[model samples]
Target: MAELRLEELTAQTIVAARNLALKPGQAAFIAPETYVHVEQDLDPAGSWPRVVMDGDHLVGYVMGAFDADATEDFLKAALWRVHVEADAQGAGVGRFAVQALADEARRRGFDRLTVVWASGEAGPEEFFKAVGFEVVGETPYGENLGALAL
Candidate 1:
C-alpha cells in the first residue's frame, strides 16, 4: 500500500525510471524517444506531467499532454511512456497513477484523455479498462489507443 504523488520528473528521475523500464523484457517505453522534451513541454503548458515517489523511491513515470491543436472539439490528451517498476506493478501504483492523471486532465478542462500503450502489452489495456478507458483503435505493431472521457 504505497501512497502515490505527482511530481515533475527531474532528469535524474527520468534516467532512473528509464533504467527501470529497460530491465523488464517486453515492457518497452516511449520515454527513450520523448524524455528530452520534458522540460520544454512542462514549461510551455505545464502539462508534461510525471509521477514520482513511493515512500521516497522513484517507482514509475507518466507524461500527459494535450492535443488542443486537433480539430476535434473534445480536447485530446495523450498518456505516454508510462511504466511502473516490476515490484510495484501489481501493488496498485499504476491505478493510482492513472487516477492522478485523469484528475489532472479534468482540472485542466480536458474533455477526454487517451493512453497510447505499446501493443501486445495487454496488461495496460486491461488496466486502462479497469479504470474506465475504452479502446478507440489500434496502432501498428499492436500499440493501442485507449480513451476516457473526463
Candidate 2:
C-alpha cells in the first residue's frame, strides 16, 4: 500500500468522498443518533474535515469538531465522524484519520478529544478503543461516549 495522506475536501474530491463504500453493516457505526452539534459548530472554523488518500484513491474521510466554548467538556473537542472504504478497513486508514483529528485537537490546545459511538456488531467500539479512546460515559440516547487524553 502507498503511504496514506490527508487532503482537504475539495470540489473534485467531494463526489468521491460521498461515494466512499463501507463494508456491509459498517455504515451504522460512523453515525450514531447521539452525535450532537450546536449552531456554533456551524462555523467552518470549528469543523475540521479531511479526506484520506492513498495516492490517487480516496480511501476514507474523517471530521472533528472544536468548540472551546461548549458547555460540556466532552463537546469541547470531539471526533465527529470517520468513514473508511470497505477495502481499506484493516490498512490503517481509519486510525490515520483519527490521529490527524487528535493532532488537530492538540494543536488547538485541547487536553482531550472525545467521541461517541453506538455499540453492537459491526460497530466501531473496538476501533475507537484501539485508537486510545476510553469509555467515559454514556449519552442520553444510550450511546457510548469516549475520550482520549492528549
Candidate 3:
C-alpha cells in the first residue's frame, strides 16, 4: 500500500483534485465536478475539502462536513464525497482517506461519521462496509446511508 496523506485543499491542488478520475461506470457514484462546485459552496467553519495524495501524486479527493444541522439528528459529521483515481483504486487509498476524515470528525468533537452512496453501487457498498460503516438507512433519492461510530 502506498503512503496516503490528506491535505487541506489549496488553490494549487484544487485543479488536480478536479482532475481526479473514476473508472468507467463509476461516474454515476459521484458527479464530475463535485469538488469544484462544492468548494465554491463550502462553509469554512464546518466543511473540509481535502486533496488526497500518495507521496507527490494527486490520487484522490474527499470532502466532509461537521455541520450538525445538515446531518440527521444522530450524526455529528458526514463524509460528503470521496473519489480515488481509477489507477489508485483497491490500493488502500480510500480506506486511508476515510480514516483520515473520521479522525478529523473526532478532533471536531464528533462521535459519528456518516456517508451516503448511490444505493445500487456495489463498489461503494462494499468499500464502506469494509471500513466499518454499517448500513443505517436510505436517503430520499434512494442512496444507501451508512454510519461509523467513532
Candidate 4:
C-alpha cells in the first residue's frame, strides 16, 4: 500500500479532484454550489473539509458540518463522497478514508458523524458496518444512512 496523505484542498485542485472522485452517477451527493465552494478555499480555522490524496490523485474526501446546508453546530455530517478509482476500491482506501473522517470529527468536538451511502453500490454498506457505522435511517433510493459514534 502506498502512503495515503490527507490535505486541505484549494480552488486549483478541484478539477483534478473531480477526476479522482466523480464518475458518472457519483456526483449528486457531493456536487453543488455550497460543497465545492468550501473545498475550493479550505479554512483550517473555520470549516471542516479534507481530502485523501494518494500521491497527486484525490482518492476520497470527507466534509463535516451541523446541518444539511453544511452550516450548523448540531454537528451532523455526511461522508459526502468517497471514491478511489476502480483499482483502488477494496484495497483499504475506503476504510482508511472513513476512519479518517471519524477521527477528524472526534477531534473537532463532534460526538457522532453520519454517512449517507449509495444503496445500490456493492460492498459499501458492509464496509461502513465493518468500520462501526450502523444504519440509523434510510433514503428514497434505499440508501442507508449510517452513523458512527465519534
Q: TM-score, each model? A: 0.74, 0.93, 0.84, 0.68
lDDT of 2 by residue, 1-150 (tens): 799999998998889988899989987676777664343444467888899999999999998888898877777898988999998889899899999999999999999999988899999999999989999999888899999999
Backbone clashes in each candidate structure, one number apiece?
A: 1, 0, 0, 0
Q: Pick the candidate with the highest TM-score.
A: 2
Give the alpha-carbon lDDT of every model.
0.66, 0.87, 0.77, 0.62
Candidates sorted on TM-score, descending = 2, 3, 1, 4
Ten contiguous residues minimizing lDDT sum, candidate 1? 31-40
Give lDDT tens digits, candidate 4, residues 68-143.
3344322255565566665566677778877887787677676788766655444366777887888887654555
After superposing candidate 3 on the true structure, give the runs of residues whose Cα lies further than 4 Å from its correct spot. 31-44, 121-123
Ten-residue stretch with the least lDDT total in model 3 = 31-40
Could you tell me how far off, in angstroms, the CA of residue 81 lies in candidate 2 after the best superposition? 0.7
Candidate 1 lDDT tens digits, 1-150: 566787887778777866875344545444323333332443246357586688788887776766566443222566755677777777777777777788887887887887666544434657778888888876443555678888
For model 3, residues 1-150, the per-residue Cα lDDT tens digits are 467788888898999888887888787777323333334444568778898888899999988877766424423487878889999999988898899999989988889898767655435778889999998887665566789999
Clashing pairs in 2: none
TM-score of 1: 0.74
Clashing pairs in 1: 119-142
Backbone clash pairs in model 4 (N, Cα, C under 3 Å; residues 3+ apart or in different chains), count: 0
Angstrom error of the Cα, residue 41, model 3: value is: 9.5
Candidate 2 regions exceeding 4 Å error are 36-43
